[model samples]
Target: MPQSAQLTPEELVEVAQKISELLGGKVKFAVIGGAACSLVRVASDAEYRGTSDLDLVIQPNKSYNAEVISNWLVQKHPKIIRSVEQFGVRIPAIPIYRGKDEYLVEIEIFDVEAWPNRQQYNIADTASNPMTTLTFSPDQYSGSSGDWKIPVMHPVWLLREKILSQYEREGSVKERTDISDLQIMLQVVDPKSLVLSAHNHVTALQNLMAKRPDLINKLRRAIVCYPVFGD
Candidate 1:
């Protein structure tokens, strides 16, 4: 298999740990995307699928800049030799190497204070709230390095992200994966609770519920039909 192929869950953990170590315990961020779904699977014993990259969302203050994070990686980590573009856009990323395995470590800064007006979905409104930080549950691993502390998003919030992405791109391959991930996650989390959280946070899910009323029901059927414990 080529080194550029899919990343193992073990490798994701190692990259996360190494990134934390490189930051000397100063940086704290939320883990998201497929890698996060993989981590959730490991922790919850859900179905496993691998990812090709690690996505991070660092809460930005006056001092933290997203562009500089890529430069800092180049300056600091020997394993991360250079920075690169994400999806051909100038999103900050560094090529991470874990022995024969290599993948891009994509980073984004979440600054709710200056969220672009054009991109504000109700879910984004909740997620980008400068005041609300995600809390990791006891069931999940805290991917900390040394004395550093890293927070993991709640399963509900993570699902919100997946749903938001699927909503944004209806039939993309990524949305298909997001749907699969949501099924697995729903097995462990109460859908009602997740919906309530969205409601409390003023998410677009409220509108989604009214507009496509059977969305959650369809997802529940998807999970029920899942091959892991199929009908």
Candidate 2:
């Protein structure tokens, strides 16, 4: 379900806001995967290449009642339809189709899963980036999103995701993105944990340069590691 649209930065923020209101105050959520770099906007012009459809990791809360969300969508939405998909869990996804295009919004809808476990580590790693203001403003949304300025990924958490994706899509071009993302993530987060997590759930990629210690050693000499700190 790959659809393209000319969305301005404000439009993206507006969508984020609408989501905020729909879900109720920015309960914990993280913009991970390709969407993470799209949101981070931390890379320079040349580095800003890969982008993907929106996929969010929502921290389940009281306001995000399953029945309530479905009911509200039914009441407010006249165009979209709801359905569930089996992806190792009873996951529900709402597809808002316009014409031949379908915008897929899938919710894993879990609580206290991996967010907290990696939050501290990610916080520590991501803190090194003092550049809060990005090309896209996460602060410009309509509803609340905690205190986030730009949509961010915790190094450890994001690394885990990359590792997981690597396992699931062993031969995908997306592996390139995952590798680049892991390279950046390791600059601040614990490299050992990143490797461990990458190998555990990461069954996708047949051979990742990041997973190769010798290749990783080569990268250390190439990619500039500018580790920063945050609270």
Candidate 3:
């Protein structure tokens, strides 16, 4: 297997901007996974873990389908997007290369309302359940780029997603990175905010927990370990 390298923060922002432009405001989406972690870290001036790909969760409207958007992106930006591989039904993973380094941008189309009784575990579904967005100004991180208002998953919800991913992926290569991201997020997120996030997305969390009863202990440990201050 060939080793994959992580994209720099600047490159991540650049790729995201390109994708946003390519879509031409046709779909509503938000950055998730390791890429979102990097964006948050860049904005907060905190150390971030390197990731090999960018993951986006998109909610496509009736006028446009997610699959069509993925096809269109590859067709429009053949030079930048090397190839696109579809996983199962809705996910389209696009590999992009810059010099010797290559990275992936994965897009997933999900509708929580439509699939209220979906089987199988989908981290994207949980991550975007009560989706949150934040703006990223590229000029603040890298002087060469302009401001990019990117929608990003809330750090708290991301924490929940990572915890579920860690348990579900057990021995996978990405499991270690998931654990690291969880720890980083726990440090930065306020305990009160985490509590509120859990409350707001209680239904999603309940469904996830019911699917993976084993995750309960890990979730508890994560919250218990978070540092808290008292007056």
Candidate 4:
């Protein structure tokens, strides 16, 4: 398979909107990974580093798993989408194209239930928590040609995921970007709120804290660096 080109933040939103439309309103999904960070950055007016592919976590219903969704998507729009390619084995990803022959970004789909350590991270509530669910308006941030409201992984959860990724993929090329994203999210999210919310998954929090002590220090510094002033 040829390497797909990178997509700007705006283009990512445009592609997300198309995917949402294709999936229809019944399917529940949220944008995660670098694509989610791009949306958050655009919404926060922070600089967005383009992402190579969009990561989406979908809640498969009785009828739809990653494979089923991919097949359905291709069947729905055969001309626009070339094909859905399966990648990886442990945590398989379905990469769906957004164009016929050439595309800027690829959409990588993952089943939320099948995601590794789903219970540890409590990832099922990714879109359930209103606080951690960011809605990206195309008109406001992307200037896209639709009123599409994209569901994104909010900074609090995103921060946890990034820290985990940093630890898991240590010394890899992606680790640097994960660290950079963590820095950006720290500036945007409330340390106190994040810590309080983390209590819901004590074991996961403990494991992460134990594995990545530097992240704990970063969170500690975040409290002082971005103090919340009371009115």
Please give the RMSD to the true structure for each candidate, in Å.
8.1, 8.2, 7.0, 6.1
| Residue-wise C-alpha lDDT for candidate 2, range 1-231, written one tens digit per residue | 433453334444444444444555535544555655544434322244344234455444567533444445445653543444445444434454457776555433323334455433233234431112223334554354455343445555565566456656657887666766665655555434333323344232224544565555533433333220110
* Clashes per candidate, residues 3 or more apart or on different chains: 0, 10, 0, 0
Best by TM-score: 4
- Per-residue CA lDDT of model 1 for 109-222, tens digit only, reads 343334545232213344442112322332233454333233455566666566666566665788678777866666666534443233322343443444456565744433
For lDDT, candidate 3 versus 4, the one ahead is 4
Tens digit of per-residue lDDT, candidate 4, span 93-179: 223345665553556677746665564223455453322444566665456654676776678777767766776676789877887
> lDDT scores for all predictions?
0.52, 0.45, 0.60, 0.63
Question: Could you say which candidate leads in lDDT?
Answer: 4
After superposition, the stretches of candidate 3 with alpha carbons farther than 4 Å from their true spots are 1-4, 77-80, 86-128, 140-146, 195-231
Indicate whether candidate 1 or candidate 3 has the larger TM-score.
3
Off by over 4 Å in 4: 1-3, 84-101, 120-146, 196-218, 221-231
Quote each prediction's TM-score. 0.63, 0.50, 0.65, 0.71
Worst 10 residues of 1 by lDDT: 129-138
Worst 10 contiguous positions by lDDT, candidate 4: 222-231
Clashing pairs in 2: 128-228, 128-229, 166-204, 166-205, 167-202, 167-203, 167-204, 168-204, 170-204, 170-205
Residue 11's lDDT within candidate 1 is 60
